[model samples]
Target: MAQPDVPWPLLRSVEALADAPLAQIADRLRQATLPYMGSSALVIFTEDCTGRPQKKAGEEEIISRVSITELDSLRATIPDEAPWFGHAEIAGRSRAVLALKYAPSHALLVLTDPQPLESTPTPGLEMVRYLWRIAARRIQEKVADAPPSYLLESRAASAERLRVTAELTDLHSTTLETLLAALRSPSLDDAAARSTVTDLAAKALVALRTLSDRTTDLVEEPVATAFERLREDLKPLTRFGGVEVEFIEPPLNGRALPGEVAHAARAIVRGLVLTMMEEPEVSRIRTQWDCDGENLLINIRDNGSGTLSADAPSIVRLDRRVQALTGHLQLEVMPGWGADVFVTLPLDPPTRPAGDVAEWNLAARELEVLQHLVAGRRNRTIAMTLGISENTVKFHVRNLFKKLDVNSRTEVVALAHSHGIR
Candidate 1:
């Protein structure tokens, strides 16, 4: 005799969620939970995947419009592991919602317009919670073990997010300021109306500023805290990998790290240590980080045979991640002293490639193409992402080449970096 709750259908649903790719995991989760609970939309936000923090699926109108601010606000209200069920602001309006937070990673999941498939809501909620945990951990592991492609895409996405946020902050702040100014004019006839409008405008301005600050917090982590998280990420390895690891903390007063930089830094160090541990002679490893106001300097050394090969695939991958951030990696293999590695990550983005937009004399489309090029996206990827044809991308690329006076993609990328076109 078998329990009905443990049927093959349930097993298949779990399998689907576990095996889905990063881009499709959200959709898979939605499908998996459909039997237990139905929702108009589903949103998952986890800082672990800094490149694309929100993985959403469901009603296009709802999922498409949900903002990080709204989600963050909702998460603030939950305050614990319990599933919060009630009306909350989502996608610019209040809607009945079921919200849950994965405590360990501080990840959030929201189901809009939720209804239990079975009469009892308890079973469905329990099952959905179980599935969400699996998906959350999967995201964490995938990001930690991210391939080179994921790393490149993550960096590009992160930069675009920062750029967009900056523009929106500036735009709204100006608009709100103007409104306040107009409402407070001395010549206004109705004192009550003027005062009410002025009060509203002032509050709007404050909220705009607060949202701007929230965006910044989402993108950056204090240097000290970033370093501490890195140590925590490596705790399991140190505990069982049979290696004595030392952590040299960075300055508490150091600048904050951009979300992508923090994520990459932790991944880079984890990869390096893992590679070092593979060498039979490796017994101890030391890692340290320092901030000189302009860059994050990382030093990782292992007391092994000094035979760690810089050409190792793992090292090469880490190097790409460093260079992607406008950073540098140096590997010094002293025959018997063990391998010492140094990584330098820039604190500020590369200066916009062209000091003045007019210097490039390129059309708007060409500039867009160039930005994607700098992100290490292939023309095909750029085309798909931009929703334009590959041939069109080529047209823009050729124009960029002539305008920037660079012949090869490598030269174009190098020139852009040199000019600070991050």
Candidate 2:
């Protein structure tokens, strides 16, 4: 039988979750179906060996309130391949729970305060089942062989530091260049030049002083720093494990990568290491990174007997992460020899022009607020600078969050930064 076409939104949701952390999977599913299904809270969880529902790091609060006994009852009521949708009382609140068995584990997607569906197609529920299946597989992999506890935490911290430092460097560099240009302006009076320099100098001094007590590097080249950090991250892995990872430095003259690219590349390499480590006999690996002005090329080769394929479960996860950035992953395996993986990530900014808040139908004032929000300005500071009241700033921020489909300031900043909205 011919299969029906999948919905575009559902497909995009699957792709987004491909590289997303397990904790964020439920929310991603919720957001993807929100347009058709209406606003509702969602949660995903799996059962442990003892039949107790275990929570992933990013599980929502509402899901936490549902008792394990309720989940067990739902599982018993629904067939493994089918979904059950019904109202249930959880934690003194009535919610609609969609229960399904997604392979090795059972997942419950609870919709709290769910609005009644007005003749939505059955295919919508099927799509939800498919999405949950994908998430379930990822959760199982984590259960089988998760990364060391500190790897993700350390990588996240490092990435944030790099992002903030990179942004600050760009800001100060532009400010200094503009200050120089202002000084060289032919129409500028000596008094105006001095005043301009004094004001800029004071701001720069404050910035420098604030960053001095921190270990953040403001002027370092990004690509080199990425490789250096990769080495540090792999140090513990190499030291304890029998593997020896040979690091080949990229050309020093190559163009630097954006902060996000550098961070993602480091993460990609780290993931590759973890994947290859699954082979018990894998003792030696060689990794290289290069930037060809347009794309970041990464090559990794291992000396163990080739057992991992391009489509291996772990590699599939890695591929999703690369694809999230519009990048590509290639794997070469020699059955008796070894495996080689290559990744290509673009260096260009996203095609969408930054500050084009029109896509989100953001008002002019809201766009102004978004820019300041991306710059890490506080609500009070934004209000003062825009000459608006504090309450007005809050109103605009709320609108920004709603328009951007994000919940927190960090997500808004990250999304805007990815779109080249500096």
Candidate 3:
């Protein structure tokens, strides 16, 4: 028998989403669903299994107003691989919540407005599901067709860097143009013109520096490069303190960390090193970074009287900073032996609380996949355990990756461990 044909509108919508930029995909999805949802605001968001939002594209005010707790609650009720439709009070008003499985991501498509669910046709739910499937498939295809994750991240970093460079250049030119224009205007006195120029220069200088710092944060630095930078930063501190610093290098081929993480890590280590050097008897400090699949394991030891208290002000400040990144800091002060500082900072964002796992809005099967993943089971092993095909296991794995905001199995496991999942 001949197969039935799909609708042209559905096909066209999927094509548009496939060709759209990543930032534009949410808007396109929202537009595609507006006809059926008629939601005053349509929010299409991707959340991890732990219910943490990874990326969202939608109306700013609506997105900002939506309670994360509400999303988490809705996520808890939705079944995976199925569409959920129901009425719930959101932002102090009743609205329809349609949660669905968008492959490689889970979507909570919410509708709020002057139009109520009772006013909309029931067929709209089916249409929403159809559109979701198309969008999900297109997203999966795009990801599959893309380069390796690292290269993609690196390219994104480079693009951001270039964008900032352009912005700075334009700002410089604009400031010059403004000053030149002011100089030529005859309405203002010389003193007034000079004052205007001074004000503009001050503001421009501040703006330029702010933009530069933002761009720096956006850039991705390889762990090796970050380590080298740390070494350079510590040189003056070490030389002045009369301390010899030793840095044991990790494999440079590992995945790179985000600029913020790298910078924070460097600063923390520098602080610890400086603290050790302050002791009159301390002369040597040793540091090492180990990339063990997921977390960056840091070990810093110093040759000093082991009387350093973990509660010391310097150690306390470093501890607070590490905790801010969802990392752990431990001090092994052997009294008479040198102190050992062990820190575990996740390469990705730390996992949500274990109880929040249910809030991640994962389907039953995906939950199973996540369990196996946390147990360090390979894809084939998981497939066999679940009596599912290897390809199916891979499908779940990819979706898990999107939810977890990670690119590798190691990262997933590490994150799971961090959240006490395993």
Cα lDDT for residue 141, model 3? 43
Question: Which one wins by TM-score: 1 or 3?
Answer: 1
Candidate 1, residue 37: CA error in Å? 0.9
- Ranking of candidates on TM-score, top first: 1, 2, 3
- For model 2, what is the C-alpha lDDT against the true structure? 0.65
Which sections of candidate 3 miss by over 4 Å? 1-217, 351-422
Clashing pairs in 2: none
lDDT of 1 by residue, 132-170 (tens): 999988887787667654655455455555665677778
For model 1, the superposed segments whose C-alpha errors exceed 4 Å read 1-6, 119-122, 237-243, 278-283, 292-294, 311-328, 346-422
| Candidate with best lDDT | 1
lDDT of 2 at 147: 41
TM-score of 3: 0.35
Clashing pairs in 3: 40-112, 49-360, 51-360
**Candidate 2, after superposition: displacement of residue 11 in Å?**
38
Residues forming the 10-long window of minimal summed lDDT in candidate 1: 405-414
lDDT of 2 by residue, 117-178 (tens): 55766556655666666767765554333343222222332344446656776787677767
